[model samples]
Target: MHEIQDPLFKPFALGGLELPNRIVMPPMTRSRASQPGDVPNELMAEYYAQRASAGLIISEGTWISPLGKGYAWTPGIHSPAQVAGWRKVTGAVHAAGGRIFAQLWHVGRLSHTRLLDGRSPVSSSAIQATGVNVYVAERDGTPGFVQASTPRALATDEIPRVVDEFRQAARNAMAAGFDGVELHAANGYLVNQFIDSNANDRTDAYGGSLENRLRFLGEVANALVEGTGDKGRVGIRLAPLTTLNGCSDDHPEITYIAAARLLGEIGVAYVHIAEADWEDAPHMPVEFKQQLRAAFPGALIYAGKYTAERARAALEAGWADLIAFGRPFVANPDLPERLRIGAPLNAHDRATLFGGAAHGLTDYPTLAGSAA
Candidate 1:
């Protein structure tokens, strides 16, 4: 009998880069940037470099500007120091022979005044992200999660300036020696605040209709595509059914399908769909997956709670071109190698998931380093 192939190890061609495997390290916020400037540091570089076995590594969500930030200690791409800091990260990953992309992010409404330099958070509407909290420093200067403050609605004229922020952030990513940039349009952040129905009640050119809601996404996608000098170098992450950050839609199916088709029309390189991961989260309909596949011409990446069997099944079924593992990569920096050999994986420390030293960040021993 012939040796069976492992689907997870299959090579994928992403734009000009040839990915060595199908395992992707999706963006996850660790809030570990250096203080005083929210800059990426050598510790962050070591964390990413340790996981270089991944086919493609998408860095943590990086704020595009100070006004776009919603969390304390998260890195930004707009400042010269920030760019130089990210250079260390990209150089480390590349030195380890890994391809990485910077995730450009803007948390529109999911912010506190403390995180915004006393400025109210801005969003598509003046709505509070009830029941949600963001990382902020207390009066004593200790960092903690606080109830998100209500956001002010962005004026129609202010939208373009926000788009330009993302455009410039992409240029900064290139300057930082990154291979590409991924727009964090997913979750309940800034872009989602605009795309979701309840979060947006504006009647301007950017709201009140499906086409209007998509205008911001389209403009930003175009800006990243044009700014980066390659349509294939740009990717988008979208969350259609997630309500984690107080964002909801009356009709997610219709809205997202139209969004996917618009992205296809714009000739983007990939679209990453973040499947809801809550304990009782509803299953994503097979029909919607097929529709997304038909609508977007490039690669499709899906991230959620996934096992190797389920991931292989999804790839065999043909909707997802790449599968991203979040926590798995956290505890198992050599995750791809471990999976290939069917080795046991390490458990991640929940307490150290964010804002910590290297103890939980980069101390996970690899298969060879651990005892049997």
Candidate 2:
């Protein structure tokens, strides 16, 4: 037998789970979850099972409660039906010898009333989020992007309920057979609304100074840890500099490093950094990366438009413990094997990226003779 000397192929331990390689398939929303209920289905199960070769797989953002949703056709874990749906997905992945984690999410102010059962959306503050469109369906079932509705600030008394929602989501994820859970604290969602300076402007415990702003995240992280029953089963995603959906911190370095330290103190398994991947976006500063490493005591995974070379370089430089690929995995279900052997990847159909069936979802072919 021949051994691969490449660092990407090397196995590493992420908390209590031992990963077979350094390639991670981070969460990417395909919006194909069964509609009328927002439940995971056979199609989603097959889609995930096909890509189980990654060192770890994180499921697409899953809403924790009815109000946590932000888009159409995305799945939720708040209901028994939704949990049953996710069971098939997790079973399929484990059958293929893969480990998967659920990405618990809430959109916060980045939501429209149509998706909220004609009710106003809630967030850290009563601010209207703009600059990015939320995906929704009209009365006629025609789906398109629309400006989000102005949201009401979560009442001081109501904040704990939302945190409990996250806790419940983690418990549901474990019941659904997920190996672990990742809090979708990144992006301009509920947790990020509380974390980002510009998005949150409250005089309450969840806003004002950095420590106050970080209060919500700490509470949610602690809840998730307690709900999961093991600190090693929890992970967090954070975007320090990315301003997508208007979620930029006043001082990204200070904000995210402190977040890393907080998660470290909470003893979550890992912290996944989501870099700005838009065209011509500025690279994350090395000094900031170094500080994040110093602050956090768990595995560090970075994702954003990473190529094979860039992934390897990050691994060798001690910058990232694991490297995650998003778009490439869509075109190549056997992405890990393809990367291991330097095979050409198939191009993904952008037209079929969102709200599609098997065309771009599970129809991607694998290596000719291999079943992966």
Candidate 3:
């Protein structure tokens, strides 16, 4: 039998970025960016910099355009202020000897009119997203769900402009000194909407066949690669099995594998796959993941309720190149230290997961500091 090494402690090269370990901090929206339009702030910078010990930190989903926003307080990369704010974040992370990547996003129908710059939201189809957006709030300090604003399907003529937004966002990320950028093509967002049959009912070239359905995504990926100039500096993330927050598709396995094959052909740096987030929702089935692994020939990062032991298993099994920790890294800023020393893991507080200040965000202590 071949001896399998622990991927958790292994050094891997993601394009030009060298990660000391295979532990990645997957992008999680904190909803803490400045409101009106989620501009990156000092607090956000501190929050990410504090957790810089992870091998690679992928910043939270940031809108590439104002029309792409769907959540309150989530950051954007479309404006000068937002770009400046991100420069501060990258500077801090780089100062701390950490590598960071920005995840460019567009919420699509997952938004309400309140979140859009104007009262208009856009999608591949004129459908409303099925679930509630937790970011939109009521008058008092309580969480409420609003009906998703009706979305206007993207006209074939307008598709090129949408593709351009991704290209510009990638350029902006590099300008801000990020190591690279990840296209948020998963989680039923704008790109995902175009891939899902139920959400995309267009009759044009970008709609009917599988090739057409995947055209927008392919263009977006091609644009990012072209924008980056170096293939090793770009990655993409997909949630092919997420059935949460009102997201679903006809055949995720076939849809996503074909998508991965295309990315592999383009020679992307990496592909982050979120198997399943919601506890009750079905995860990326083992068979499906095997198929995706077979289809994609890049550094593969897996996220979703993963334990260090499981991460090791995945690496040993050759199923994943990296394991991304979400809530674990949130509570244990010294996650790499804890893993290295076999220290106890910190319990994450669910109450303060979103829409809050420093308590659960920045107050988590490192092992060395906590013991002292």
- Per-residue CA lDDT of model 2 for 1-372, tens digit only, reads 778689899888987899999999999999998877999999999999998999999999999999999998889999999999999999999999999999999999888898999999999998887666899976676578998999999999999999999999999999999999999998899999999999899998889999999999999999999889999999999998888887888788999999999999999999999999999887798888989999999999999999999999989989799999999999899999899889988889998888878998999888874545
List per-prediction Cα lDDT, in the order shown: 0.92, 0.92, 0.85
How do the residues 188-278 of candidate 1 rate in per-residue lDDT, one tens digit apiece? 9999988999899999999999999999999999999877989989999999888879998999999999999999999888999999998
Residue pairs of candidate 2 with colliding backbone atoms:
none
Better of 1 and 3 by TM-score: 1
Model 2 misses residue 341 by how many Å? 1.2
Error of 1 at 15 (Å): 0.9
Which scores greater on lDDT, model 1 or model 3? 1
Off-target runs (Cα >4 Å) in candidate 2 are: 1-4, 369-372
Give one clash count per candidate, in the order shown: 0, 0, 0
lDDT of 3 by residue, 188-302 (tens): 8999888877778888988877788888988999999887777888899988878655667788788889989989998999989988866576856678878988999998999
lDDT pick, better of 2 and 3: 2
RMSD of each: 1.6, 1.7, 2.4
All candidates in order of TM-score, best leading? 1, 2, 3
Query: Which rank order by lDDT, best down to worst?
Result: 2, 1, 3
